[model samples]
Structures are given as C-alpha cells and as structure tokens.
Target: MKNTYKVNNPATGEFISEIEMNTKEEINLALKKGHNAFRKWSQVNAHERSDLLKKWMDNIQAHKAEIAELMTRENGKPIKESLGEVDYASSYIAWYAEEAKRTYGRTIPSHNESKRIVVTKQPVGLVAAITPWNFPAAMMTRKAAPALAAGCTFIVKPAEDTPLTTIRLIELAHEVGIPVDAIQYVIGEGKEIGEIFTNSEFVRKITFTGSTPVGKTLLKNSSDTIKHVTMELGGHAPLIIAEDADLDFAVSQTIASKFRNAGQTCVCANRILVHENVMDEFANKLTTEVTKLKVGNGLEEGVDIGPIINEKGYTKIIAQVNDAISKGAEVLVGNEYNANHQINTYFVYPTVLKNVQLDMKITQEETFGPVAPLISFKELEEAIEIANSTPYGLAAYFFTNNYKTGIFLHERLNFGIVGWNDGAPSAAHVPFGGMKESGLGREGGTEGIEPYLETKYLSIGDL
Candidate 1:
C-alpha cells in the first residue's frame, strides 16, 4: 500500500496536491538514512547544533508568508490564523536553539572518598514525529523542535491533509545544512505510516499528536518494543461558569476559544457549563456574540471563522448538529451548512444550542466544530460534576470571582491543564499534556527534554 494522499482546501473546495505515497520499501530506506544521520547529527557539539538550528529559524522566518499560505491552502484555516501558527512555530525553533545550549550534565553526591558518580543526558536515537492537521505548525514544532534540540534526528509524517507546509519545512531544514536524510517527510494514511515507525527497530522515540483512541493504539504498539513515546492527544475540554463570574468576559472568551479554527482544537471548549444564576444572561450574550461572527472564506478579510478541515469534519459536525436538534436542543444563532455561490463549500455556521443535557452526544462527544452546547448547573459542585463527566482530561476553563471556588476547582478539575478566569492556554513553559486518555506524557516546559533523551549513570571506583 502506498502512503499517497490528496490535500484539499475546505473553505473553497480547492485541490492543493496529490502527494506520492511512500511505500514500505521507501520507509525502510528512510529509516536507514535516519539511523545513519542520527549517529552523525548527535555527534556534533551543542554549540554547533544550536548554530544549525539558528539557520533553520532564519529560513522559516524568511519564508513565513509563503509557508502560511501553504498552510491555509491545505488546512482551510484563515491566512492570518495560519500566519499565527508560523509565528508560534518560529518561537519554538528559537526556544530549542537556546535549549540546545542548556541541556546539562549532573554530578551525584559521592558515597565514598575514592568513588565518583555522574549522570548525563544523551539523545535516544532517531525520533518519529507524527503530527495532526489541527495547528500543524504548533504540533510539529512541539515534537520536532525539542527532539532536534536534544540532538536527535527526525522522521516526520505530518497529517495527510496538511503535509505541504511540513514537507517544505523539512526541505528548508535540509537546505540550511541540516542533512537531507536527517529529517524525512512522509504523508499518507496515519495508521499505515505509523506502523512503519512503531514496528521498526531504528525509530528510538515516538511523538504523536492526534485522537485518544489512536494514541492508545500507538502506546500499545510502542510498548511491545519499549520505544520511547510522547503523546499529545485529544480532548473534550469543558468551560465552566460560576454564579459569581464576569458574564461578559466569560462569554467573549468562550466564543473566541471554542470558535478558533472553527472549534477543531484539541484544547478548544466543547461543553459550556454555566451557573444557573446567570445562564440566561450568558446565553443571550453568547447568541449576540456568535451571531455577529463573520463566516466566510479563510483567506477573506474580516472573517472571524473559517470552514472545517475536510469532508470528514463536515460530516461529523453535521451529524452532531442534527442529533442535538432532534434531542430538543434549540439553535439560537446559525444552523445547518452554508454553501457559497451554489457550490457546497465546507463552511459550517457557528452553531449555538441551548437546553442541552449531559445525556446528549454533543456533550459526551468532542464536537469538532463551531457548535457550542449550553449546559446549566445549579451549584459549584454541579458545575464541577458536569466538567469532569467526560472521558477526556486535556484542558478545562472556569470563570469565578470567589478565590475559594477557583482554588477548589483548580485542585479537583480532573484535568491536566486548567485556566482560571481566562480562555487561552498556559504558557509554552508549562508541561502541556493531559491525564486519563488525553495523552501519555508532557511535551513543553522543563519536563520536555527528558522524553527526548535517555539518562546515563557513570560510577567510578578506585583505579
């Protein structure tokens, strides 16, 4: 089977390219190159590696506008939004450039007068980085940046839908003196390509960002060989509103957070659990906010929201909307799909559903769209109950004025990352992974370097 796939622009239903798939034979060849490259790449000093990475950074910024256009064309995200992704990605390259210099060795306390103990971090080997379509630049950087900084080579297989930008990036890295085979690109069915990584002995570490069920499967695959794996998987994140919260701020934040990228974000708000005291007020404000949102081509100016990723996302969002409506949830703003100029473009209206209950699929499932289902809670305990009711534990947000309430939920949210009185995620300096089925390990902050490296201990005795 070939790893060939076609990329489409959902906003305008445009065809980008039909990528030639990598065969198993090609995968083996890449693996061989990755292994050979790893030995040579990892042997270089930290300063040399940092300088090489700096070249890649300069190249990325030099082609920022073009790269963002490629991203938008492939992923259906707004051009400006895609630019934001590239900007964030550049920061990661810059971060890793500095990190390469800071990867340190440690000295252990001596147990005997004539004995010395030492510990050091070394790159494991070739890293297999599998990234998803949502936030392609960020997810790619999260894995590739740190791994490269730790002196590891990479075999990056970006999601089939949005592989052009990634392929361009890998090519650019090669152009800047990073060995061609040091970073390989393969685009295709995620499962087919993933097996090539997990079953191969040459791939020393695996970093994946995608769905939960898929993450578990990857975890199981890597477990048989005990290959190092770091997963940044899916989430059905909840946004909680307390009675004492600022209704205006909470509504604005939720709309922005959830509707960003048309609500395809793994950390995007899916379920809205508002306190009973201000449910009506919040709903009214949310309706006005959502109704006023500009929905058009991603490349168009003043477009607040864009189309979903692809046909599968279109079908999923349609099904979820239909199910919610049939179950008595009222649509307050936009409903159904919007086609442009008689062509059934992938544009979905920013949907708002009220009278939602915990039993509905919209609340239980991750509605990867611009639909916000409203759930009311009579008390703080009830809000917490609804928030933790899902199977995911990726990211959750709560708006509350009471310090006690914020602290209480902060400790009991059953989530890996939480935001208080805010909608954006934690800084890139924090450990960014989730509990339960969300993912396997941390990606950023100080904890990120450990996964890319293996610790070695040295003990010296009297000679």
Candidate 2:
C-alpha cells in the first residue's frame, strides 16, 4: 500500500488534506524520465531556455495571489510575507533567464603554432533538489531556476508539510513549455527518495537546503558515486549592535529581521550581541518594538508573526527557553506558552530574552523560532569574538555608522554573507551560502550557475 502525508494549519490546529506519497518504483521511473529529458533539454540553446523561464515568471506573477494564499495556508507564514516571497522567487527565475544567455566561454592562444584551444560550459546533467518547508516556493525557485537555465533536467522533493506549493510550481513549469520529463515532483519518505538520488548513477548533482545533520548524511551517501552536491544547511546567524549604532534604527531592524517568517529563516538573528555601553538601551527599545507585532493566524491582516510550524517546533522552542531561564536568563517579552495548551495549538508568543549567556542552549543552538537572545559585549574585539564563537556562520548583521569599524567587522566576520547597515540583506544578484559547518557551495549571483555547469576544454592542430 502507498503511504500518505496529511497537512495542518498551525494557527488553528486544524487538519487540512491528505496527499498520496510516491512509491519506490515511482521514484525510479521519475529518475529514468529525468535522465531521458536531459538528453533533449541539453540540446536546447540558451536563448530558448531563457524564453521558457520568462514564461514561467509570467505564470507566477499572474497567479501570485493564489500562490501566496496556498503558501500561507501550508507554511503558516503571514500572507504579506508569503506574497513577498513570491516576488523574491520570481526575481531569481528572471535573473537566471538573463544569465543563461551570458554563460561566457574563453578561447586561448596555444603555445604551439597552428594549435587552438577553447573552453566551454555545459549543463552538468540530471539534478535532484530537496527543499525544506520554511520558504517552500522561494527555495524551490532558487534551486530550480538555475538548474533549468543551465539546460539540466531536474526533480524536486519538497518537504511533506508544503508539497502543494511545489506541485503547483511543477504545473507552472509544464504550462510554460518545460518538458514534462524535464521537471518532476515526488512526495514520499525522504530516506527512500534521498537514497535513490544519492545512489543513482544517472543523477549527476544534488542541491539540498535543510539541517546540517541531514546534509552530512547526504554527503556521506553521495560519496559512493562521487556525485556533486550543494548543501545550504543550518545557520546560527548573529546580529551585532555596536555602541556607535543608531539605537532606534538598530532596534527596529532587529525586530524586523529576528521575527520575519517567525524567525524560521536560517539567517535570522539567532544571537544578538550588543555593546555594553548601549546594551540596556538596545534591549529596552527592542522589547518595545517586538511587543507591537501581532501574533495570530497568518490570514488575518496585521498579524506580523504567525504560529510555529508545528507541535515539534513549539515544544523545541519552549524547551530551549526553559533551559536558558534555568541558566539565569530573563525574559523581556512574550513569555512561554502555558503547559496545559494542547500540542495541536502550536503558537509560541514572539519572545525576546535578556541576560543571555553564550553557553546557554538557546544561544548555542539555532533557535528556529521567533526568539531573540541578547548577549552583551564590552569591546569590538569581544563582540567579534562572541559572534565568531559558534561553529555555524551562514550570515551575520552589524549595525554601525563608523566607517572603519564597519570595514573591520565586514572583513573579520567569518560568515558567507554580511550586512553592515541593512538587517535584511538577501538579494537575487548576491551570492549566498555559509562557512564552517553551515553548509557547502553558493546559490546566487554570477557564480550561481557554476554548480549546474561543467567545463570542457578542446584543442585542435592544423597541418
């Protein structure tokens, strides 16, 4: 018998609908079809591929309202944020469409007379993309757009909680002239589908955005075939407020960044480090700004923070907060949920904790919810030390008006992406990834298509 997965609304704790999971045989068939499609897709020129992507973008824009509602219902993000994500996702598709025609190659003069050398880029092959539930549509397009632009056939296994959005995405692809076999969507146990992706010889590359532990497992599995993998994994991003920073501006940006998407983002301010001289002022201003946010069902207008993804997420946040409290940290606003509340009622108040210790679990781990743990530092050196202490370094935010200090932090920070004055720094043209245990490879900018393309060198000599 085939397995099935059910969906739920975290805000109301209501069951949505059940969907059937693909079987092992179905996965294998999808792989075969994807491989077959690659043979044809790789033959299409870059301009034609660019044209197809433009149509896909138009489809997304035409259905933005429906897409945003579906995403809000499935992922529990505010409708406003959902619509914003749709715009973000479409921008990537449009970017890669233009980038496809600009895949440059070089011709070099051979050392030996009468010999010519040329290097060219081509699609790597079949690609498997595994995306998480947090930003289902955006992550899907982020990976899919590049792969398609590079002339590769691809398959997507979206998180079970948010498969509907991906299903709709594949529908748009087909409607916009993407070959049926060139893009496939399968929903099932991740282990079964992941094993096929990692072990299959036909699968040449895999891109996954999820936890570091799972990324390690996929890396280990892919080692057998030596397949190329791009892993955008876990992050414990830190935000630093220098003593010289504008207090009100820093506090407001912190609130916006920390609570966006209910802090489920990998790059959200997991640990906020404030200079000792301004710590008290920063904390007070941050608390006041956070309280202004309305937390409720995502469909309601002015609901800034939606419910936690599910019961597990709510429990995890509660446990992290309790652990910190036991270690002597104090709550500033948004206290823990009551113990009597049903597990199905999965909303955690948007929380901000003060007097946080670096050793506390909430500070060390990725608090994947709307909780900001503030830690104070006396000097710039101390602030940098505390920010770089964590093994994860995906992104960091620093607020400062001092030019020298801004350059110092920008250069010294170990993260892949850094925002000097801007709290929200994500862009389609900028490269994004992580350092240390955060993940591997980059996903955007001019180099975005590098993972999907393989280079070849050719030489000829004439008599």
Candidate 3:
C-alpha cells in the first residue's frame, strides 16, 4: 500500500518512469546505517578525508556531460545551466576538501596561571540533507561536500521530480571511497522522509532548501529532538536602479539575473524599483531585452528560457500575470502566447510589466517565472522602503554611481546578500543564505562547514 510517483520531462510533458516510495522501516534502516558509519567515519584522518573528497570531485568532473544531461532531461533547465551547475557542485567539493584541512580550533588565555582552556570541533553526527529540484546537482553536492568533509554521514532526499542527478552523484561517491552507508539516497515523498528525519534520534542535523512553509514545518519537527538545522528558503529579491546609473548595464544585468533558469532562481529580482526620473527609459530597455530571449526546449541550442516545471507552476504564473494586467499594470512585452506552438501548455511567455503597484500579486509574491514587474521610486529612501517591504529578505541588487548612495543603500537594505550594480553575487567561496522569513543558517564559503560541526571545550588544571 506504499505510494509511488512518476517523473516527467517538463518540456515535452512526457512520462519518464515511476519511483516507489521508501517505507518507514526502510528509512529507519538507512538512518541506523548512517549512525553506525558516523562512528567510524568521524575517526578518519582529516588529510585522508580531504584526499577522498578530491577523488569524488575528480570523478564528478570526469562525467560532467552525463550529469548535466540527466539534470536537464529531468528538471527542464537549459543544458548550459545544467553544465554550469555540475561544475559549481564539483567546485564546492574541491573548496570543502581544502577547507577540511583548516577546521582549526583555538586555545584561550586563562586568568589562572595553572589553567589551560582549549576548544575543538567535531562532526555533528548523522545528517538529513533535503534539497529542492531547482539546482538538482549543485544543491545536493553543496550540502553533501561539507557533511562528508566534517565526517558526518547523511541521507540525501532530493525532490521527487529531480532525483536522477543526485542518485548518480551518490553512485560516484561510493566509487570514490565514500562508504555506502556514509552517503545514502532516498527518492520518495518529502513528508515520509522528513518524518523519518524529525522522529529519528540518530539524525543530529537537518539541512533543507525549499519553500518557506515547508521550512517552517521542518523547524518545528526538529525542535522535538532539538536537532541542528540550516534552511535556505524562498526569496523576493528587489533590483533598484538609480537615476544616475548606466541604463544599459542595469537592464542587461536584471535580464540575466531574473531570467536565468527561467526566473526559477531563489535570488532572482522579483521586484524592480527604478528612479522616477529614468523609469520610462529603464522599462523600454528591459522590454527590448525580454523580446530578444528565446523560449523552447532546454536541450535545443539558443533556447534562452525553458518550460515551467509542471501544470501547477504554469497555472500560477499565468494567473499572477493576468491579475497584474487586470490591475492596470502595463505590459510592454510578452503578455500573449502562441497557441499554435505545440508545447505551449508547458511554456509561459516571458513577461515584462511596468506601472506595477505594491498591491499587485506579482509584486507581493515570488513570481518564480520569467516575469518582470517594474515599480518607480523618486528617492533613495523610497527605493529602500519598497525593497524591504517583503517579509522575505534573501537578496537585493541596486545600481548607483555615487559612492555615498552605494554605502547608504548597502547599510539599509534588509537582505542577507547585496549585489551592487551586479545581479549574481554568489560563489562557492562566499557564504549564501537569507535573513528574516527567507530561512535560517548559511551554506558555502568558510562558514559552509560550520553547520556540520559542533564545538567542544577542554579545560585543564594543575593536579
């Protein structure tokens, strides 16, 4: 009486294959194995652990094309983006491998002459890493790399829609000396796997990347066991354009950031705030850029945008756009679709909306599509207010020529990360997370490995 789910190619809406759900007993077994493995894995030499991670990274790089193809086939992201994700995932492993060598502790000065205080870090024990489908390969690996480097075993439950890439990566991990129990894959319902993570005493940490609602539920569940958790959830990033900034630069960067992965990214600019003096000019430029994009099957060359993940996503995006238009928002480009196009049901025409109001659904929610909603602001204060209006504070961007303006906005923006005149500010070596409801904790950079570790203090006194 177990449930099962079918996978689909979002572009063609073709049925792929079905995967059966893992039962409660099976999940418990995986957790037990992980707990047992952690006992031995935690004792491995740090340098030797780093060498093993390097091998895994090298193996992944060797099959980069294969990994990218599986990701695009399942997730409907452009092949180019898939390839980039694979490379980025591998880079995380490499970075964490080096970082493993430097998980250093410290000695503290003591007031008493005969006292010594020292602190060290140890693995947080078995982890349950739940990743979303958006960046199939990167999200899983980004969490897995640090978990393994910190000597913690884990069970990766990738989204049901996109499990192939992560499954293959786990297979590679085994080939590169990672023990089978040290890295396990469970492809099934989020509720089932999440329940296992929450109820099980073996799981010491939960690293999740998904919606804010789901993250909140996981947080509540983990509280039962008082488990450590890191979450990177939804975002409603705002891109502000100043009157004196270069119009072309702002337009191009916004287009690239907002439309990447068809605007499915968590850090995409959901609201665009432009100075009233240059609002008209910026809208026209953005319209021109949106028109130039090519939307089609991800595997096809020159296809700039891909289809929505499923019918639900397609319906939601269309409704949001329609609601905005009905509220008197002007559409400079792409409110219409070509019904004659055979794959039209799965495709959402990339849209650009101007004269957007704060009350509009498109402005209030994370559009999660290739839709651009533009709003006008007369002063820096107004721009800051609009940008911080959302409960979510994942990321924000602004273009300004004045040093004082840049400094002022940077200080006032209520976001975890800021992009100054640039849209994509994330990197493997830089910490990535959000503030407020966007979710808790951080991933990547020097702080990336910290979540997997727990600090221990030792004090010595004269006999």
Q: Give per-model TM-scores.
A: 0.96, 0.98, 0.97
- Which clashing pairs does model 3 show? none
Model 1 ranges with Cα > 4 A deviation: 1-4, 339-344
Model 1, span 292-348: residue lDDT tens: 888878788888788877667888888888888898999898886875533336778
Q: In model 2, which residue pairs have backbone atoms overlapping below 3 Å?
A: none
For model 3, the stretches where C-alpha displacement exceeds 4 angstroms are 337-345
Candidate 1 colliding pairs: 3-21, 4-21
Model 3: lDDT of residue 452: 96
State each model's CA lDDT, in order: 0.85, 0.90, 0.90
The TM-score ranking, best first, is: 2, 3, 1
Query: Which is the winner by TM-score between candidate 1 and candidate 3?
Result: 3
Better structure of 2 and 3 per TM-score: 2
lDDT of 2 by residue, 26-92 (tens): 9989999999899899999999999999999999999999999988988889999999999999999
